[model samples]
Target: MSETRPAPLAGLKVIEISAFVAAPLGAMTLAQLGADVIRIDPIGGNIDANRWPISDDGTSIYWASLNKGKRSVTLDLKSEEGQKIATDLIAEAGTLVTNLPARGWLSYENLSQHREDLVMLRLNGSHDGKPAVDYTINAASGFPIITGDDERPVNNAIPAWDVAAGLYISNGIIAAELERRSSGKGQEITLALSDVMLATVGNLGYIAEVQATGKTRGPLGNGLYGAYGQSFATSDGREIMVAVISNKHWRGLGKA
Candidate 1:
């Protein structure tokens, strides 16, 4: 598969200053496609470091899986000297990624100052004044209420909002790079978990419009809605979803 890769980012360097799944995963994808990815770790490691699945050699497989093809360098950005190192790295780097909020990371602003041509991907919980984590984003966007059994609605089993925001951030970085090739200027990309969930729920934006007009949309059971969709139990006792939109197919299925 390596032989087939075109490696669009062969000479580009990316500095990833992020913890946990989302931001790291984005940087890793760029690295796999041939970008030189450098992970910036805090002196004592980030909070999410070594939280699970330790190998015999004490290496965290969870971390390795997400950060496989990247180099790591530790620095204490809180100190003046450490901040200088991070700023220098960013000035040399073509792209930078971070999940930490701008307010929390003082060096982020400084790096931008030093490298005006640096493309940045900043991921955070919320774009608004509020914090935008997985659970809070899900609830506010009505994603939880639309999920799970009717007895009690729940959030998704996975951290989908975070992942989505990261992917969006990655794409934004690439797009910004493309624009820079034409215009010769860098860009800052921002993504929030809540905005990502809201965009996902936008598939049912019409429903939201109706609800706002004094109509309520709730609990669609395991039956067809408006004679088009149905959720049936499979032979293995699992639910299989089928959607029939055309009248011809509906009639052929004996749904008269």
Candidate 2:
């Protein structure tokens, strides 16, 4: 039998101060994988406390799902004592994940004073720090133009950018943790929501395509980009997605 090993993030302590999808989800991901995560909120709860998908008694399943596996505390962050508690927690945890405005007590500069090697990962809406969210970021990603069957631009309902940013946040924290372990130093990591979308569009060659061809790709609804994929409806009123990513797969599809 193979030897057993502890979780990659086991024994890691993290503090998360956030309200919505990206930061909370990132922290939750870490918590699920064995990091000890403590989420700090206002006296009652954060703004996403009553977010959609509520249960009959009025509980936010959306928020709960994103924050599962993480311990939570509510404090009056506006008060000096409350700020002190939060700062002390951050200093002890040594890692902070947040998407809130990082001014005031939550600022990296302020927290780093408590622990010289604190790893603070802050998320911003835009590169210049203007406010933005998943819907707004997705609107600028150029995906909507190729999302539907026509060029009218249909935005997907899914918060793809937010999900991507959440994963990126998790990765950022891990990388920072590793760096801190090696160098005995910690640094501030800033991730812009818009930059996630921009990076995705660039990685997918959409920006280069526009530059090289001077035109946007035509709409291809429910189809792969630069590949063979389609959604098919069966006579039994069911739908299935099919794709051929290789020569063997294409031959198998032709045979079928």
Candidate 3:
């Protein structure tokens, strides 16, 4: 006999109307945790459907990787009928996760009027009502400047802000669900990519140090910040990166 395991979000349902990284990744996280996630894309698919990192056969590996374990539906959000259908689905699911702007038919005020206990999680680029993306946010948050070597600023290979913001949005959804259980009212949660990166920079004490001492942190190539760490080449021509952050670790590395 096989053992049966229950998922944490088995009974939860989420209607995800989003494209690109952050919102889709957040919905995918919820789906992986056993939420019934219904992803509504545009008629011919959203912007990410044909995004890069594709296979030779034109399949978008990037999109597939992020959109796993979710049911998909296509609709023309611009049309009145399509809008009604989306609204119906949203009302039925009682939860929506989207990275689109909070306006038009998808606005919290418009949706909440239909279902009072509707939980809507909106992901945006900036909190100041300005448009932004992962790369822009990364640059604006001062990460790119301190990422690479001392030569010049380099953008990161990974969309760090997008991934982090996605996880944060997922966490927000879970917390909102818990709150709704007791309050019997759904709430709107808004997350911005820029805010997430800024918060991360602040949490790491980078922003505080700059504010207090008026000093800018420079980039350290392959070295850990405030620690004894660097990459070294072995005698056999092999490379290894090591970090000795504590006294015990330093002693252990020395002994080795």
Candidate 4:
């Protein structure tokens, strides 16, 4: 007989007061890893509750997919009683994840008062603290301008910024958890959506390319950037992306 082992985040409890992609997705990832995640929604639901990818019967597949493995609760957060309840939950859990423009009762100042060693993470639209979303952030990040071979900028169908922000949120949460374990104290962690885009574009050399040469890489449809790679329709009518970035790969391609 085989023995069962508990999950890595087995005893970790997370109180999530978030909506949309980054916050919910991060909390959902922790829940999947066996954390006790309690997602608090409004009396009806959050903004993305009825987002796209609906089933034939009109079920919110998008919501289900993002919020999977987490427990849900609907509370009238505007009410004083609801705020008190939520404060108690955060004090008990000692951890929170959120991306909303949270202030007042939901602010770190207020929540930390309840539990001094509370770890709270918040996501903002930009470092300037202005309002923005994935598409808005991506537009100025220079990705859409070089995405496709078109006269007009081509926006990504995939919310790449949101996806990346979600991954960052998850990573930040784990780091904060480790810090709490080591210091016996908690701190606030924050990330701006625009900053995530800037970090990625800068790391990929796109920002440097424009500054160094005063020229930007134009769109090369279906081709790998700065690499010998392209997608072709195979004999089976299925499309395959081929790359020959190295001499060895080129030789291997020729041999085949």
Best by lDDT: 2
Selected candidate, larger TM-score, 1 vs 3:
3
TM-score of each: 0.80, 0.94, 0.95, 0.94
Model 3: per-residue Cα lDDT over 1-256, one tens digit each: 9988989999899999888899899999999999999999998888889898899999999999999999999999999999899999999988999988779899999999888999999987888868798999988877777776786998888999999998998899999999998899999998888889989989999889999999887887788888887899999999999998899998898899
lDDT of 4 at 222: 76
lDDT tens digits by residue: candidate 2, 138-189: 8787677778897698888888888999999999999999999999999999
Q: After superposing candidate 1, which stretches have Cα over 4 Å from the reference? A: 1-5, 52-61, 103-109, 203-208, 211-213, 221-256
Tens-digit lDDT track for model 4 on 1-256?
Answer: 8888898889989999988888888898888888999999998898888888899998789999999999888888899999999889989999999987769999999999999989998999999889789999989887787777776788899888889988898888888999889998999988899999999989988888888999986787778876798888989889988998999999999998
| lDDT of model number 3 | 0.90
Error of 1 at 50 (Å): 2.6
Per-residue lDDT tens digits for candidate 1, residues 144-180, read: 6645558577777677776777677667777887898
The per-residue C-alpha lDDT of model 4 at residue 27 equals 90
